[model samples]
Target: MDRSEYLVHLGNLEFFHVKTGCCDADLPAQYFCITMFQIIVEGGRNMLKTIHSTVLSADVEDTGLNLAFCFTPECGDYEHEECVNQPNQEETSLDENLLMEEHWRKEESMHI
Candidate 1:
């Protein structure tokens, strides 16, 4: 993929560096490098599975990238930090969380 298109896809993935209302120019080159690694490296599926597990195990309140909140357009800003910190009305239910995980698994399979 070209740079702009790559960024758009990475942006959709809701990484902290790309989703924090930061402009594309503001992102560090390392983020792009990591993404490229994920896309191009053989056996990257294991790496991504580990990352996904780590994110799920992490304290969502402390970390900025709460998977439950990550996919929404409304989450593309610092305001998402507040949602992560506070008990928001839009918090995902247990079933919803399961659904989201299943959806992500499907998406990951498609990409692979």
Candidate 2:
């Protein structure tokens, strides 16, 4: 319903990862790759929002497996507009600076 409520619902949800085998020739015979993932759901709702997943270390000889999981929020229509506008703003600022430099160079040439 609200921001805090949504967060609380997500916080209560259980998170776990499922490992899947990855086929790679470079990996040793004893060493195999495992993929870990967890499903994130909206609080109190049965809807599936996003899937968080990552790759685990494939080195069997290594004592510890370092896992790094990256979570990317699904972009909605409204959020997509903001993402597009940011790049346009940067490009506009760069174009203005280039124009100012060009004008300054022309003035210097005239004085010379």
* Best-fitting candidate, scored by TM-score: 2
Which tens-of-lDDT digit does each residue in 1-112 have in candidate 1?
A: 1221112234433432122121133323211112122323355552222223211322334344423222455434543445435464343333444466679889999999
Q: For each candidate in the order shown, give its overall lDDT on alpha carbons.
A: 0.33, 0.34
C-alpha RMSD values across all candidates: 17.0, 20.2
lDDT digits (tens) for residues 1-112 of candidate 2: 0000001112343333232232343443221122222335557654433344233334544444322222223322222445335553422232343455568778989999
Runs of candidate 2 with Cα error greater than 4 angstroms are 1-11, 29-45, 61-112
Task: State residue 35's C-alpha deviation in candidate 2, in Å.
Answer: 8.3
C-alpha TM-score for every candidate: 0.24, 0.25
Clashing pairs in 1: none
Which candidate has the top score in lDDT? Answer: 2
